[model samples]
Target chain A: MAKSKKNPLRWVRLDNAAKIYPAAMRKNWSNIYRQSMTLYEEIDTVVLKSALEVTVKRFPSIAARLRRGAFWFYLQQVEAAPEIQEEKSHPLCYMSEKEMSKYAFRVIAYRNRIAVEFFHSLTDGTGALIFLKNLVAEYLEQKHNISIPFEQGIIDRRVPPKSEELEDSFLKYAGRVPASRRDTNAWRVPGEKEPEGFIHVTCFKADVDSAIALAHKYGCTLTVFFSAVMMQALMNYQKELNPNTAKHKPIKLLIPINLRTLFKSETLRNFAMFTVPEIDARLGEYSFEEICKAVYHKMGYELTQKHMSAVIAKNVNDEKNILLRLVPLPLKNIVMKAVFDRSGERKSCLSMSNLGVVRLPEIMQKYVSRVDFILGVQATAPYNCGFLSYNGKVYINLTRNIRDAGLERHFFEILRDMGLEVTVESNRN
Target chain B: MYCVKCGVKLEDTEKICPLCETEVYHPIVKQEQVPPNYPPDKRPPAKKKTKIINGVVLFLIFIPLLTSLISDLQPDGAINWFGYVAGALTLAYIAFGLPMWFKRPNPAIFVPCFFAATVAYLKYIDFVTDGDWFLSFAFPAAMYFCLIISTLATLLFYLKRGKLYIWGGFVIALGFFFPLIELLLSLTFDLRFIGWSAYPFVVFGLLGGVLIYLAANRFARDAVQRRLFF
Candidate 1:
């Protein structure tokens, strides 16, 4: 049954499998593909404590799933009466330092700041970004024991994507790139020699408007500029590793494109696909004009609706191969190995994901401190960077999971040379 | 006692409750009541659907194996292990994955159906080749390692949920446990078969124990759970 129209739209998870992974949070980004959202505003710790009181007063829905036959399924929920329990945890919430990663999506907070992540089915990033921002914004504004503005509590509930949008977008974007047997011949292939463990870096509060102006001046979106800058740094690092590396031919880059607008769905799982463009390392050193043009043209072609449809078809049909479905148990592992090897040959030298522009009220900024994004790279992301914009500012979260530490330093140096003074954020995690 | 579904009481005089009329076991001299509906009941039959679907899934699963087998089948060399792999998955889907949809489901039917499938695959290999190695070596060895643990786990869960499942779980647990034990002993000290038909008495014992327990127990009338969800 459809929910009461009077009830404000809130987050709804699609499944636990999607919620269990950290990647689900990073890629919650949607773009021209799909962009569905809902928002809650003017809620602070005092008000939030009160809002939870009101919010949880509603009925709770739970999903149960069984793994091993003898193991029974368990129940979980997105919303429930918090007063009935001491704490609540969501599926996506994680602690990297913990073993087994027995993670939950919800987190409890009677006081202090809070951020929430949802798989697209629950709420698109835009909705979550806004919800979290205003949640904190309203939380801080109330901290001073001050009077509230009437409109601050206002919320805008966007309509869920239609079934037709879901069907169309799913037909376009439900594509999975099979594990390739060939190494993705990216600019530089990672090896045992690269580093001890993958490298991770975060830079926050970088004057986002200036970066936007710089990006606009160069005729590119902030995402494009940041991506270009990341690649430029990686290219310089590669040159340092081996002088001959940079002088070699251009490298290919992989960027994730959300197909939200193309196809809409109230359910969220994997709704994005990869767009890999072969970029010349030389392009990073060229004028911003050259870099911007290349990025725009590449994204234009790779993120198109038609091509995405083709990809979806290929993903479905590819899995039907009898070799994959009927391989002997003993030999199934062998086949998977071949697929993985091929993937290395096709790996992207660098990958950039821009969560796009996030807008927030001025009041929320004080309590939020800042927002951060991190990409999972078993090692060697080619060059990996995540850009999330909030309050007209962008936070560039980078990790060289597969590259050497030298590469990270080179990236920052190149940013400086590009006439951008980048202030690096201290790593908290 | 009251009917579990509708809660109408059955009387000593009536064959079944007149209001809740399901088949009654007592007097009325075993004369059958009029079967609820007239000439035809149109809830839809599952046989045709289950058979067709089972056939289709079997075909879908087998096509790949057939190809792999055709591509790799040999006289006495490199047996098409891929066929065995495909065959195992086919067995899994056909046996465990397909039953939940039926209006009526009986574990009595499902358990033995899979039990036969497991034994038949082993026989197929040995029959085509006439070597006892597949059964003598792998059967017991594998049973001891995997089935023993799985059976124990199943029993633990049974204790947690309810003892009502013992009619099925108890018999199957033995079918798995004895062979596994024999297999382990044969490998350790060495023995002959323990000989085929060695567990006839054991099977009888398991069956008798369970039957006695069930015969003494009375089932409480309770509402059956049902739901229709995608």
Candidate 2:
């Protein structure tokens, strides 16, 4: 049943993985993203707005704003519907704390697309995807006068949210094990960054079957193959840019692993930790097969339940520390901000997050044309790549703040060489 | 239609690429001009009126101030305790309330202003009490405070790296400050110099020297950082 008038507004805590985001955000950087789904027809704003009004109520976590208390930052429930805007020029634009305090996310509709950009302090890509899927379902249902059942990550807004859906999975699944992984600074891609607040988004479209065939040929999954390819591209670029320093620097890709599969928790907040898959160029140049093997094996070792649990335990243990708890919020923000800047992007050349297959109901799939996931650029790391496959098409969206197209060119050339048809799209304003 | 620069596919209505601001142009495709219906500018949620709260607090303080002023007025038409009370209230206003008037009041400016207010308050107290210690004791005390605060402020503002040296200097100065204070007190009160201030001076002098030594040596600095890695 729909949340009743008497059902009190529920405020939730920031998930364990989400605690650092609010503190780490700056004017140029707020870890935010825009996950958009394109339809064959122009978006009907009226239906989209009404659909959001109902759908957001289902996601109490996303419907809330970030609030700082004496102890920690939290999500406070907001009763009003989020303002739906026409698609602006940029995706994943900078969101200030003031904006975050008012609304942690936004919904935009333009032409054949409806995108939801979220301040990652509220939800991760999975959590955001859940909200987006529900919104799309409601939109399609209202627009076409059809009832779309909630399944495959879609939720019925009429149903009240479960307590487990709102739980902080990190705290719930934390153990005594300590995290052991450490990374040296990775090779940085050198290029002049575009003007502040401007991001260069390049979407590389390729056939899913061909990409998968290529991955299968190498005995690796799609993500592993892509990681190897990206690392290879960076290694080549580093050698091209500065061959002397290339041997000294390691090429590492920071890949976020979803922990929900292991913890058995269904919370729609951030329940993920990143594993750094690195190649030591000092050891010598690695062949494509060797790189793929390294990436596949490393990802297999790092993404295990035991390893992920230890990572979560380390983060939760820090949060649970009595001394850290006693530190004032302002002081904690300063320290966390410093730690986030120094430790976040320094050890990774770039980030590659693949959201796997995006499945929709058969009835709803007719109206949807494509889905795109755009990861925001980091402070130090200029570019980040996010891929999502829907239907037979794979969308490789590269969000970069730099002016150089060398990386993207090299990346697409690799695909083209493999006989996979590639179409490059960009928001080049 | 597509943006020529960053190359993300553009909507038919879009005049330019939203991400890179590159103008959208396609030789074959004619541009359809439909202005986007963007959401109204989100007026940053009305900020809380801290100024009004400060005004209310100032008003509350004024009531007691007025009462004190009225009570302090003697039948002989003399402003006896009123001067001290009014001076204190003025000092309180300067120290606490004045900064609220500006959006971002610079600490560099306000720190000295606060010290001036404090010194003025001390002078007013000395005058009201008919004491002659303003020059010998109170002035030196205020100067000492200003010296420490200004030194710390300058270090915080200017010194970006290797600030331990500035800290060590401040500590050493602070150590010497106690002896000067003791000498001033002995001179003013006609008390014998019992050398009590020398104890803290010696203790802090050693501490400051050790810190200075650590700041001077690169090896010692790295070792301290490793040991105190928070």
Candidate 3:
């Protein structure tokens, strides 16, 4: 692909969800995560570098660096390709402002996996996954000399990047009606945090068919079923960890909804929102079936076109407010930080994001064995669970900064007792 | 392999999950060999020094110097007032500008330079006005203050223990320095020795004694830590 003689100094406004990340990002908490794909063969650095070199140009938004404006933060196109480093032992390590001042994302090649960790301000999981898949495809094309055509989610390097690819989808889909952002404080997980700020990741592998069948038995989607299972696990642990407070506290699960499906957005930037399904244990002890029923109905109600529209509109409305728009970026950051501290992570005890089945092109699928999505632990919500299923296997990745493995242990045990075989793996040596 | 607890995919060689510390046990894939992808450990990268800030500082310093030189030259053929301006500018450069040149400048060295600069400026002012205060009052006052500060700084830099005791000693020394300042002032101005300096001497002397007494008690230190939440 030839470099277009277009104006190189291009910049774009941050999407609605992207705005919160820049303000909330701190030294101890970067609000970043690594979304990676492991190939069947060892990664060749030379080929991987060439792949990223050509692929980043196709997704112009991913190649940009974050810049501060008078009233807001924007992404400015960078001329130099980002350096792809060897994979570090810990994934999603805290990125200081100093490191972020250079670039918003980095590519790492280690063994069979090529991971891209992005500062959340740049894009959401869906957008990031698309970029990674394209990089891998490009790598395969360059290394193996294969003609793998661009598929639905992956970008084609032969064509120039369209303007719509950088569009702020929230503004496009925002309606006039505003939604309520008020939420009661959810039960926070109790545990000791690793002093050195270590994050523990535990991945569980289950048969995709069995998990789906279990969800089907409850007459709900896989995400709802998983969320219910997670909430139940939290309830059991809360009973053990804080027996006195367990009855009063509400167990809520955060599900980050992909807005693209509902809004028909082709924008590769952030376009996701969250809907929290909460269960108050004070009412009574909830059986697994009852919890599943509640989660299914609540998710169905909240994720409807009108209800989700109000959620999107509310955030866009906040951003579009005359007073908020007039405030400078620094002052806006203070407001956003306060709002996030009070309302963002406080609404949920744990977050469970399901990337769903990651379908690849037949040629690419053969080389890819596992697909994983990792969400970093937030300041308040110390534990977060991410799910990605591929090739008949479901991978559940639980990320926590706290020392206790009780949550993960309980979660998998529940699934195992329910007659589904569960296999666990960890990076801990 | 993946961590059954956190669900993060892991390299096969890891015996435990790096994130959660969950032991790795895959029933299906046992020790089929591959070298570790990551290195043994990670060391944080060195922070990049911003050279541009030094350039900006130099430019800012140049502006005031150029302005004073031009204003002084236009009014007179000689650099009479410009010498004073140069002295003040030199002092500013030594205090602020010189530190930007090195990553870490020893406070022991800079502190002495600051004293020397203050003394030089005082001498310059005296020479200009044909005053008689530099040798009697200004020099002694500046030297005593500089000596006290350098002593405290030396103790802080070199000592690994008894910081509180050192501070208590310095406070006591400061209490004693007040009367000497008064004595020098009276001698330089040809005035009678008034007991005015006694107020601060009593107050600081009492406070210093109390601090020394507290520093001598281990229980006091522990109590302070508990009370202060340090």
Candidate 4:
């Protein structure tokens, strides 16, 4: 909501889940993810800008910029939307700290595609998807003179912003007993890094029915199936790199689970946690079936309401600690950065975030040709995988900052070997 | 068209399979002219503006130097206390400011330069004071310190692996070098030694031994890594 003259400025404390991003951000690296929709016609920047202007007013938390206070970082509402930029190089190009302080998200236009790249501190994929869908709906209504329905994540801009949508759900649902934060560090994937910081995005388009059938054959969900396949690929890569079987570390994939499905919160802020399902390579070789079973059970165990509440309690309790709260923001950032480096990306080889399936209203679906979700590679880790099914096809995006393509090759090859046809598209020349 | 090696279909814009780098070829189907997923314009992220900060730092360094020079020259016609201030500021600039000019400063180059600047500063001080200990104490002491540090920097910067081993060896070498420093001080300054160096040598020797052991023993290394969360 826009601040009145009496208030002057409206600011909100970063959510418990968002507090780590501002601290862990580097000069050239930020936790960024992209949600895009490719329409049947080329994007009109003039109309897109107007659409964003209207859409931003509906989501106050997503329309804010990061600001540093004495003890913590907060988000201050910006009156105007960030200028819609033309996609030049790649998706999720580094959003520097200077840029984040001004705008936490950017709207990008390229040909027929309209993409929104957001800093993780702003919102998770689910929240960002809702924002994107509404923005696209507005754009379509304005450009094509179509009256799209206000259902299925396309919020009505006429309604005032609700307080519940901006509430920090982590604090609301924290339990008394906190979960243990102890976890073994997973093996890191190594590759020759691109010197110029160019991100390579590769998309694998596969049939939704085929992938679902394969997942059903293994008696696991699609997310679990993909995670197991990714772990298998990582296992093969690690084995190729290190022949000594005894020295192999546990191969783990950090799978982000949307807490909205489990909890009864409707806030658009970050409301997701990770379930690290791993296969210990040090023990012995694991078959695909075994890996799938391991991932399925581990995810099931950690995805429970009690287990997730404990995890949320642990995070919220850290925010409530008096000693930590008294520490100044500069010193706090150093401590938070150290903590993130120790337990964050190091505990998983890579992250595979599946946004399950995206559905839009009937009126908005005709103009949209494709929808994609892309998660940037972790700051230290070189690779990350994100995918979502939109119509009958599933778009599996594999993004990496390194020169090696072994992981992508192995992952797609595994899918192809399972009798599923995969069509590949990439930004790399 | 599909990648022959990867067995996955390829987009029309893909000349080669991104996965296996296998060239895409078809018997009859020709590659069509189509726009890629992303735009052709490659706008790399803007690099941080270090030049402005470097200029500001230069200005900051100049302020103190100018103040000292003016105050010293105003007091006397010849420079007296200004030499000491200038020498120290010069060393500070060489150590910190000079490296800020490069995007990725080579530590191997900068480390040697910094030690050389330290030695030169010490020599300048000795020359100004007309001290007798310049050759016997300051020169050799600074040179030895430079040698050790430069070697450490060179090895750590050039070699990717064995960082633990290098640090361990360096620490052990320091354990031996401390005693030598005590001997040099005793010889140059004619001071009575209380065997203080041996205490540090014992501590460093044990610490260095542990580091080397950790480097050698993978099991211990992994255990320590897990415990320390390094």
Best DockQ among the predictions, by candidate number: 4
Better of 2 and 4 by lDDT: 4
Q: How many backbone clashes does candidate 3 have?
A: 27
Q: What is the TM-score of each candidate against the true structure?
A: 0.44, 0.66, 0.67, 0.72
Model 1 agreement with the true structure over A316-350: per-residue lDDT tens digits: 45445565546543354344445444563246665
**Which 10-residue window in model 1 chain A sums to the lowest lDDT?**
A62-71
Could you arrange the candidates by DockQ from highest to lowest? 4, 3, 2, 1
After superposition, the stretches of candidate 2 with alpha carbons farther than 4 Å from their true spots are A1-8, A245-248, B1-230
lDDT of 3 by residue, A1-429 (tens): 123358655677777888888888766997888788989998999888888888877887777778788998877666667787866656787777667667788888888888888888888888888988889999998998887766847667878788788888888888779999888999898876765567777777889999999989988888988999999999888887766653568999889999888878888898888888888887878999999988888878888778888988999888889999999989999999999999888889978999888988888987888888888898767899899898999988899987678888778768877887776665554
Model 1, residue B201: C-alpha shift (Å): 99
Q: Which 10-residue span in candidate 2 chain A carries the lowest summed lDDT?
A: A1-10
Interface RMSD of each: 35.2, 7.5, 5.7, 3.0
Question: What would the TM-score be for candidate 1 when compared with the true structure?
Answer: 0.44
DockQ of 3: 0.13
For every model in order, the TM-score on chain A comes to 0.62, 0.96, 0.96, 0.98
lDDT of 2 by residue, A1-429 (tens): 123367466677788878898988877788988898889899999889999889878888877788897878988777877889756556777888898888888898888899999888778888888888889999998999998876888776898889878878888777679786465888788777665466767777788999999999999999998899898888877777776753568999988877876779888888878888889877887998999988888888888878887888888888889998899889999999898878877889888998889999888899999999999987778889999899999898898887677787667656767777766556642
Fraction of the native A-B contacts that model 3 recovers = 0.31
User: Tens-digit lDDT track for model 2 on B2-64?
Assistant: 567755555554565544556778888788875442322233443346778888988888897
Docking class of 3: incorrect
Q: Enumerate clash totals for all models, in the order shown.
A: 43, 12, 27, 0
Report, for every candidate in turn, its global Cα lDDT versus the true structure: 0.46, 0.81, 0.82, 0.89
Q: Between candidates 1 and 3, which one is better according to DockQ?
A: 3
